[model samples]
Target: MTTIEVKCRFEAKLLRPAKPGNDKSWAFVVLPRDASEQLPRRGRTTVEGTLNGHPFQATLEPDGQLSHWLQVSRELLEAAGSVVGDIVTLELTPVKKEPEPDIPADFKEALAAAPEAHKVWNNTTTLARLDWIHWITSAKQLKTRAKRIDDACDMLASGKKKVCCFDPSGYYSKAFRAPEAENS
Candidate 1:
């Protein structure tokens, strides 16, 4: 029942933004390095928190070579009536439930169409499924995402239970580390 509360500014820096004439960009609120260490895990932790009085559940993810961050979707900002650079108050408690990835509709349909793959998917653990979903959704392009769905169905049907050569941890894959966490 350890509840971690923090009051901090909303960091609005764009994360891995697309180049000129590119797709949409991502943004997040950087968790203070000290506060990040208080969490149970690095990435994909379910958090119950309030931002500017708006309660929400957020997936705390690692920033590349930096501290953990809460993805500040436009919806969230609007709901909280917050904008970039606004100071925010957060009261967070890590929930015990396993996180479920936001599976794209196309991917779900693809799996449903492939019974064998769907069976495999159903039998996989939540974290394993999350990895597959992450790998697919991580694709920056529409075509690439579609390709991943096709590849995933084929691979799963062939009895592959996990994503090939995929690292679920942000460490080796993305080298995400906070200055304080670097030594931890």
Candidate 2:
């Protein structure tokens, strides 16, 4: 496997700002071509060394951004007397992408049913409906994929237009159980 290692300084803005002490951590973005050899799931590979004398765990996002959730205490930040402007070094070792999940047929039917709106949505690339399609279709299981579709339909039918807030978890609970396989 080919691994790309990058050294970059985190600007602190990438961290979850809502969480306290998040500014002390750093985020490393990675794009792994293979689907099964990524970090975190396999085991801890020490992606981040000591940062301001504190330890941290590197978390991988679905978008391929590796985030180091620093274990630094608030007292440590106060003692070091540093704020968001402080630079933190990050070393990212590329892994592999997870396998793309399969989308259910019902979900595809739901998308197909909105042919006119789907056409309109496809016309507007700025709205990210295509990205939503990609995300929804990536589910590996039939039930999961159908749930994603139902959630997406509910959101689109409501005239919200944006698919980012559509939660498949809720739909999965109510629908999408024991669904038949979808033809790609």
Candidate 3:
């Protein structure tokens, strides 16, 4: 079989804005609109790329706008010898197959208890599973989270293939967003 190479390249500032100078010292780079447009989809996109000459893979999250952003971990920064406020070079290509996401322990047990829901989940696409996980984990309150898990099981058992009323891009609901820049 032949392979098709569809790639996009751009330069962006590597910003270390999330919980700086600690165990959670995180960084990220945003893809400009023109470059983001070349991507396969506007929703959360997974890609394998090189960051400042170091190879890496990440899921690029939509910024609620037309663009996308990446969350670069501290370990990634150190591996590439990159720092915040530096112009980082990147090349990305969309992954044809998404990797499986880890299921939360509570959700795992919930699924196991509900055979129909578990079967539906097992048959759903990886991306849909990711959205379900995202919807479940995005809840900020404990009670809300438990309710979501219960609702997810019910929905799945009812033959709902995807999470209902979830805005993965977070554009309208403002539920999903990149880490705010320290200077912003």
Candidate 4:
């Protein structure tokens, strides 16, 4: 197993800005671009670190605008007793591998029933498989999840490697989303 560790120490402001027409603000801590460039990979990376003396494990994601950031939920912020503009300390180390998302039971059955699709699915890369699972699980409604599973099997059997119209990196995906957009 190979391990790559990148540590960043900086003072960043915790900003809570609302998206246009959303009337809700999101809090996030932006990482400096230089620090971001030192990470092992872009996109979602499992990270363990400390924020204002509170330990946390989270996936660091790149917002389209910020390059990379940690979305500080209310619970996490409160745990650290952090407030906006406070200079919080961050020490992060990337995990060697990202764990796979759990496939829903119905989706597993759908794949099993389609041997051809299952074969193609078995041959897909781990990242590709993760994307398929993420797309299906991101559906907020049961009907949508069912439809995605069917669509996924069909696409896989047809030899498609990726979920159509889905952002596998999760920049715009519901599974992992950027806190805010510049065009907001």
Candidate 5:
């Protein structure tokens, strides 16, 4: 196994608030040692490092949770090294792994008929799928629910994974129209 070591200094300004949904204690940002290829590609690599003093490991995701943010342990860093502010430097190295296979076409075909929507949906991450399923299943009317499925499929085929009702510019588009508001 190939391993590289780096020395990092930690600063207080480099720390970010905990994620809204998790009990993470600290977060930091670190540039990948190798930038020739994006991190998280199949068989690409795993990054392991110590921030301040806390040890952490991170894997690359095609649609990464921490696209630009890196989570770390504040207490760990303070315990391992002296953190004066928000900046910290540490040694990091990448471990390679095999890539995952592409999604199956049959799975994609199971989506709604809107080709555009299907395309977008197929490209979205699993978390997006869970969110969409929850949203669609919560609808009260069968017709409304069907319409949501159609809209979702169309959006996916159109190369959009989210924001079904709006264009890339964030304007309302005729492509996706939600059901009219019910009379109060």
Candidate 6:
């Protein structure tokens, strides 16, 4: 219900992006690379925009390939009277400020168990915390995720300010990527 200062406007075709376990994923639109360049950062950015006249506020995720993508919820699609495969108009702009990402419970617990890591986490900026969370959750497997959590705690305890060696834009290292579309 916030008034977004409209910036970049464009149209894109909706597609169903894949989820690891859930076959039925939300319709999503990948922002044009140029449009993404207009945003604040190549990392995770918060945006508010109208999709086919339906209002929405969401954290725009990096598309791994250097652009950005917004997951269109079914409710938003229905409200817009559109669906996957339809090209939709979008009046997009980055939010004035970034929101903190909610920490996963397990990660929160691990931080709590490590006083030094917890202290560092509390002292870090929201963006750094977000990157740490992203690096941990980007793991496609449960084992890798657990290992990342432990490593994160150790790194933080040792005074690391941010996640090192993580390619947030997925432009390099190829460790992160936007979910593949069903038809991709």
Q: Candidate 5 residues 1-184, lDDT tens each?
A: 4444433333333444433236444544434434313344321134665665567675422212222234455666567664324456555445443223333343344564455566566677654564455345545687866766666666566676654332311112222221221222
The TM-score-based order of candidates, best leading, equals 6, 3, 1, 4, 5, 2
- Comparison by TM-score, 3 against 4, better one: 3
Report the number of clashing residue pairs per model: 2, 7, 0, 0, 36, 0
Tens digits of per-residue lDDT for model 2, 72-126:
3445445445444455433344333322333356665776897655554444443
Global lDDT of each model?
0.68, 0.42, 0.86, 0.73, 0.45, 0.86
Q: What is the lDDT of residue 38 in candidate 6?
A: 87
The order of the candidates by lDDT, greatest first, is 3, 6, 4, 1, 5, 2
Model 2 residue 145 lDDT score: 75
Candidate 2 structure, TM-score to reference: 0.31
Instruction: Report lDDT (Cα) of residue 78, candidate 1.
Output: 80
lDDT of 3 at 139: 96
Judge candidate 6 against the unseen true structure and give its global Cα lDDT, from 0 to 1: 0.86
The CA-based lDDT of model 4 is what? 0.73
Cα TM-score per model: 0.67, 0.31, 0.90, 0.65, 0.35, 0.91
Tell me how many residue pairs clash in candidate 2.
7
How accurate locally is residue 135 in candidate 6, as Cα lDDT from 0 to 100?
Answer: 91
Put down candidate 6 lDDT per residue, 74-156, tens digits, no spaces: 78888999988999999887887668889999999999999999999999999899999999988989999999999999999
Please give the RMSD of candidate 1 to the true structure.
Answer: 6.5
Judge candidate 1 against the unseen true structure and give its global Cα lDDT, from 0 to 1.
0.68
Best by TM-score: 6
Question: Judged by lDDT relative to the true structure, which candidate is superior, 2 or 4?
Answer: 4
Between candidates 4 and 5, the one scoring higher on lDDT is: 4
What TM-score does candidate 3 reach? 0.90
Better of 1 and 5 by lDDT: 1
Candidate number that wins on lDDT, 2 or 5: 5
Question: Residue 57 error for model 5, in Å?
Answer: 2.2
lDDT of 1 by residue, 1-184 (tens): 3445533333233233223123232234567766666667665566777777788887776665335777666777788777655667666677665566677899999999999999999888877887798778767789999999999999999998999876544666783432221110
Residue 86 of model 6 has an lDDT of 93
